[model samples]
Target chain A: MRLRLTPRDPSYFDLFAAQASYLVVGANLLAEILGADRATRKDINRRMAEAEHAADDATHTIMRRLNQTFVTPFDRDDIYNLASSLDDCMDFMDEAADLIVLYKVDELPARVSDQVQVLQRAAELTAEAMPRLRSMDSLQEYWVEVNRLENQADKTHRKLLAQMFDEITDPILLLKLKEIVEKLEDAADAFEKVANSIETIALKES
Target chain B: MRLRLTPRDPSYFDLFAAQASYLVVGANLLAEILGADRATRKDINRRMAEAEHAADDATHTIMRRLNQTFVTPFDRDDIYNLASSLDDCMDFMDEAADLIVLYKVDELPARVSDQVQVLQRAAELTAEAMPRLRSMDSLQEYWVEVNRLENQADKTHRKLLAQMFDEITDPILLLKLKEIVEKLEDAADAFEKVANSIETIALKES
Candidate 1:
């Protein structure tokens, strides 16, 4: 066992970990909003906006540090990409939450909960994985698990799409539900992107 | 007005031009299919697939060359981004054409024709812009115009969405048209991304 003596700024890991933590907040909020009443959902959406803003701030901090700092723990491009993808995860989840409130849909399909659960799991994995970037140990499991979860999310999304088309009768309601589900799917894709970025970074380091 | 010898690969521009030209083929096919009967639309979609395949090959050529070459005309990441965005333009347009055929919609709202027309013009502008990367001359107009066109397309899309909800009563038909329009809108966004990438490369060179 050895301590890293290189002058790499160790705080980039902390920054990334901070940024990823918001994903968990945003995802959990998304899960909460789905089970909420209309008034409660509006309140949860307000909280989601705050969480998104916090995530955005965390990202800006990383970018600012990147701009000023000469050296980084990884390739600057990879850092930028990882940060952007993390922000995307928050943005997509926030959009899903916002749309649910804006569309005033009384209920989402049961499969949507399945979609949100995948996001929550992916977010937790990402949060856990970020701190490990410095050590770069056991990262293979994190990315591989996230990838598997994303595939599951994708299957759920297609089924939900087909099911909605078959069962939903009102075009306007159908439009609202379709858009909301798609946003959740986008969030899932964004999570996969983050995992892929991590995999590239880990492979390069190794 | 003098050029000293630099060992930058000249063919990257040609590769990009080939890719952008497919967007024109794609955008034009999208426009043509909007006017064609179902039989002809199917044929146009077949041709669109061929154009998309050509575009994919062009992107692969660039990627292969990028991996092999030491010096690029611009930043390697910028080149990668520009190529990816160009590919996105083709993919989104191809998807729109495919969905139009798959959905078997008899008619699209007239504004959708306006959307395709915007894509056609943006594609032409992009094809024209590719050659100018060498000099980085007069690129301001290309990106600026593409941004303006994207804004217009966004407005058109929102209006179209509102109108569809207000007018269309059939849920199935609404889903088909909505998905198709969103794909067209996504194509417009992808074209704007290409322009944005070019803008970055030009700014760095300037």
Candidate 2:
């Protein structure tokens, strides 16, 4: 029996992972932005906005690769979906930060900060997992860890929301906190989607 | 150049569309379940719970088609992304309804109901647009209409959320309402994703 490998060139998956890594950096920046005091809202949100643009650029490169290339290091659909999934994660982060700026939130909620930390961790795990995708032997192990991180993030998201409802007395603050928590949850879900896509790639490879 | 006049089989797209239509029906059922009397919670939520199984079935069929078929009616990546987007919409709706059942909300907020209706309309447009993918020329108008409907749904979602924050008094109720509205907004976003995918297909044909 002969094993066939997908022909590779510019390494879309690698570029995609770099973008995912940038998203994590953006998440960290957002965390810092939220924690920072009395800074201009524009300055705080800039990192997140740039992250969104970077993700989009990666997605555009992915589309071009899919169109012009005959072979990929991964499945064509997987490449596109993974790019979009990472983009979705950044999109949520950017949206959450944008909301904070738009609403002129004075103080960052501790719960939101915790969820962002989890998201940063998850994004880092995702970036780590991407290179191993080229080799089928290690895909399962990375995906399991990714899935575990996502589950942990989900638990944090639920707990944060529950606490937000319990402790927050102001209606506007409650709404803002809930939005931030849910945005974090959505971003976590996006990460999970990438993990699931990786699972599919594993299935395809195996 | 001779146009490829061969009519590819519609069974795949047809089945896919039918399942999406069922999901919309399920969304309506959820709206009804959420709005039902407390006495009916057990029965209505149970039925809504069952929709997950049905959605899974639809998803399985779509995935199978994606795996086995090479020349899809549309771009393979678009088909895959659109399928997952539809599934996500159903999943979010199901998750929100499950939350309602678990939280034991006695009465439905009018805003949640309004958002659900918008989602239903968007889903209907999706089901309508699916068959047109088989013959892009025939569905050009529908594609445009679906995009317009998505725009309408987006406006409704934003306006509804604004009103939700403006009118709701209790912090707890405000949290629940925000979650429900956000879930519905996501459903609308999923529909818009599909609409955008179709427009991309239309562009290819034109």
Q: Give native contacts recovered, as a fraction, per prediction.
A: 0.21, 0.14
Model 1: DockQ against the native? 0.15
Restricting to chain A, the TM-score for each candidate equals 0.94, 0.87
What DockQ values do the models have? 0.15, 0.15
Clashing pairs in 2: none
User: Per-residue CA lDDT of candidate 1, range B78-190, in tens?
Assistant: 89999999999999999999999998999999999999999999999999998888788899999999999998998798778767866888878888898999999999999
The C-alpha interface RMSD of every prediction is: 4.9, 3.5
Give candidate 1's TM-score: 0.67
- Model 2: per-residue Cα lDDT over B103-136, one tens digit each: 5566766666766777777667677777666766
Candidate 1 has an lDDT of 0.88
Q: Report residue A17 deviation for candidate 2 (angstroms).
A: 3.5
Residue-level error in angstroms, candidate 2, position B104: 6.0
